[model samples]
Target: MATPEDTPSQSDSTLSGCIRPFLTKSGLTVRCQSRVRSQCPSCAELYRGDWAAIARSGVFDGPVQNFRFYLLTLTAPSFGRVHRVPKAEGAKVSRCGCGARHSVTDANLRGVPLDEASYDYAGLVAWNRDSGLLWDRTRRRLRDYWPSVEFFVVREWQDRGALHLHTLVRIARAEAPRPALLGESARTANAFSKVDGAFVSWGEQGDCQAFRADGDGAKAIWYLSKALNYVLKDAVRASGGGARSWGHLARLSTAARMVRCSPGCVPRDCPSHTHTRYGARGHVVSASRRTKNRTGWSFTGMTRKRQRELRSEWVTAQAARAESAPAEWAVGVLEARAGRAGRELRSRVDVLP
Candidate 1:
């Protein structure tokens, strides 16, 4: 005899395919499609891979000789001095600013400030809050100099928990400036905070390297794709420097809480998550958009919306196949057996009456 549990439902079968399924407002079951690795590794990896594909299209889909590409890194201006322990493969320094010869493995003290009381937590919070504006100003400044400039940028968290940017910039070869000049221009660009009127700028440790769309360009794209892993990470949750690091983050959180998010922001009653996430309130990854005068970030026009459409199509096709599978020999056999069992039970009930 077949039990009720053995009965297959179309909705249940389809929903079972997703690791984290949920119901829509109209009662449609669907995958959550979260980008955070902690929430959904499957969707996060897919998101990373899709962006990587779009990034490579910009570099490889067009004429290799007509355009110039550069990988640029911009850092946040220092709010306070902190220990600078080098990584295992990084260049060795004799002594950090704290007058201690720190080893590469001294992870706990690497980004921790020497004087916690004197550290500028408010300034750091303010800088994090205003970093998106700073990048916007920097990009516009670059485009003013070279009209053909297109870019893809990713925001990453430094060991000290400050936000920094990694950008891939593309420009017409005929109009491109020297790599140093471009980097210097971007690094020197400044923005005034709209919320509090404070000046925001990049640190002096900026870098830019030019690479062609052939030969060594493959390595550059690989590097950018690898960096996509950082996009979905939580800055405060990812830090692991022991009690000193925890204390550092706690102070930053407090500062973020007290800081005004916007002109009309009320500190205690504000509903923004910027207060919880250390004053970060912008997208982690971004690219230039297509315009009449420009080709945009992805040369092939790949986008998130397009990816979603393709995914929906795939899901629909799978559902159709599942619906049709009952006509197959194995499923037909199971259905016939269940029907016979059902009739036998009905006959038994009739005899009992």
Candidate 2:
């Protein structure tokens, strides 16, 4: 019964430029600037580049000997037992809790719960919801121990859809703790959620490694690039997995929908996408902000605002240069004027004869 007008257009011929673009008040075409790789890869790459520059400034902009940098990783407590499957090639993995040795190619079962009925789906969702608060408490504890600490943290999604944190921590050399001690302090830090008053803590798996900005420049740069890529890469690929993986995600989604995100939230009526995204809500990447008494995350005090201002200045300068140069249309205007003048002269002479 659908006519051509009723049917939606499928052709991409009308689309051009950015996948998501909008007009500013001044009629400038501006992209939506999504940081999610799945939404708009070009904008996401730009987002990663901007953050990478800021992260690099924190490491390389100051005297390298004055500061000590550590890469720290923290994970969420296990909600339940999952398959012990490895994705890397030739990685040694023992028998899973379900009494089977999963191979590297068993991708679909990698994060699937050993027993779906017994898996703590609600607990997993709650932890993801309160993860930001947990990190805040952990960072505060670190600052209490060493007041000179500044950090850049990225939240990444595990194969099981849980959120884990990777932090680039900086401290004055005089106050820096041993890398092992730093990791232990962070791993043991705990918090109580404000929403539902749930106890939150990190997993036992924590690690920290110290690196020097002044060390072999090539290796340092390579490591930095890899870290940035790890942070910016898509958290979850939208692939069609086998039954076990699909069912595991479905249970998580259902748990997310049923849980209360806030004190007054109605689970069924709330419009927040936290329920849809496996209860993950908040900024995935964050850095310490400059304060009156602190150097903050970036030693150079670089920020996204500074980047925007620089781009605006460049655009203005380009416009000025364009206006100063003679345009191609100006030549045509001069030629038309000369032709009109000659015709006028000829007409006057003919009248005189």
Candidate 3:
């Protein structure tokens, strides 16, 4: 039954005074007390507690499980021309922009997609190639726009083979900002702009469109997960050589190489590698590697359900650890001080104990 009047505003000295002792006892140290950000020491303590709990759980006692595997595809715009070898005998050909008749030997005669018209397509491919950089840039821009908002960027290619980015962001209750305002700031930051505006608009195309999934954790994850599927479908189609209009082979080849490379190599020592440690703990867990034909790579180990369960357990453990800490000691001290002050006020007002 805490009302607005009963709650302390973020700027209030009384709230800081009440919270400081508990924070200190909890081993939370803030470099900039004015900023009110989650201190690293606090995060480390929570992470360690979660890790200890998970290690005790024995959920992953069995052999590793292989989770779902997906194929991603995308139709990329043709960037360059090549010698056109006619499959049919005596096939009629047209002259190229270079004034050479389209033929096997005449590389200049090869027709390529118009550069300006295909600028967006090119940009999209480049975006896919450097989606990690784009995500880092976007997150940094968002931080500048709103100092309290924090996020982690995860980049993946969709089945259709288009590059997709998934960002897991956390905004403190006191630090939440308007999504619309952040979106405006994002656009202004040149997140999807180009030297020429036409291609810029093309590359910026995504089902998620604007950055509207702010503050709402479930909504944001859903949007990102859906977008991941969309790009994966496109990537798969492009990889399968089905999108001939976009000159599928080259695009497919590039995507195939990327898939094989596994762009962000999740090291075995990285906390993300441990499926159970996600969100609550920090333990480096390497992605399961599946080698195909001595060249290709795919992830293996841990079903999605198990991963979810493990993550839930870890989070619960962290909350328990936070709650079990000596918060009551700080509370007891504050209550004693408040009780003495109340007694003094009552004595002055001629009240009996």
Candidate 4:
């Protein structure tokens, strides 16, 4: 009864279970700040791997209710049909070109073309490339609704490989000039930005909903974080390393052949619990070596403030680094990184309008 959105993309042959598993008996903990670490080589959050960044760099800080937040998702148009979880009971059941039922476990085939000969791979890639521009424009649109606001966006792929956006919009107490206006909000996020009386097209499908900072606040943040982790494999893959997580990776056999196991038996050499079902939705949005962001807006009021705070903290930590230099060296590095990231974000964005 669950749709593709509800069903996670995973196969029993590939389900790595539990929170990052411990493969070895050592039980040792190591640093995971390395951007190249993770199971999917293509994860982008490799560099921005701060969990606290979710709250500190979130739409707003503190004990909730200080600001207004909304959870918005923008989806790309369907290029062609592949397989989909039914929207409801007895929905039209379309078969792939291969003429198969396409069970829920056929996750790898979710966004793939039934007949690769007819799929628009090139168009899909171009849309993915300009995705950042669309997001930048979305930010500009939000400004018209609220005098001052902030947004946190994460880009992921639909089961069918179309890139979509999951955004968290923040408006401070001083920013919301009027009461909640769902009409304006929908026009801003779901519809395109305006230019010279013309509606600039964003894509095909978009959805937006407003949620207060009460119970919905944490839920929004968690959803954003989860989305980021999903597309991370592509980022790390382009960085030239196998995706590393908190668990120790174990290998059972090189072959994909099924291995029978005894009841209540767990193999010590089994690979770490890295499940791809909930993994990346698209391929590489942009390589890790690029200086700017090809995805979300990482620079806003909250982000800039958080960057300054992090610079101070990094400066304090320099005492533990090279003895010849003070915290200033590390501070310089972080500042440069932040600056480059902003430029990279603008690179794709400024190219659009």
Question: Residues 43-114, candidate 1, lDDT per residue (tens digit)?
Answer: 666767777777877888887688888889999988789988877856677788878888866878877888
lDDT of 2: 0.81
C-alpha TM-score for every candidate = 0.84, 0.84, 0.31, 0.48
Q: lDDT (0-100) at residue 113 of candidate 1?
A: 85
Per-residue lDDT tens digits of candidate 2, residues 1-353? 22322222221111122478777799666667778777887678778888998989888998879988888999988888999888888888898998888887788997888888988999999899998889999999999999999998888888788999888899999999999999999999999988889899999888898887886667667657656776566655354468888889888889999988888999899998778878878877889999999999998899988987776676556444434543533454466669999999988995785
Summing lDDT over every window of 10 consecutive residues in candidate 1, give the lowest-scoring window: 1-10
Candidate 4 or 2, higher TM-score:
2
Q: What is the TM-score (0 to 1) of candidate 1?
A: 0.84
Q: Clashing residue pairs in candidate 1, if any?
A: none
In the predicted model 2, the residue pairs found to clash are: none
For residues 100-144, could you state the per-residue lDDT of candidate 3 as single tens digits?
Answer: 555544322222333323323333444444433344465577667
Stretches of candidate 4 exceeding 4 Å from the true structure: 1-36, 39-48, 51-66, 85-100, 173-200, 215-221, 236-353
> What C-alpha lDDT values do all the predictions have?
0.80, 0.81, 0.35, 0.44
In angstroms, give how far residue 163 of model 4 lies from its true place: 2.2
Model 1: residues >4 Å from true position, as ranges? Answer: 1-20, 89-91, 322-353
Alpha-carbon deviation at 342 in model 2, angstroms: 47
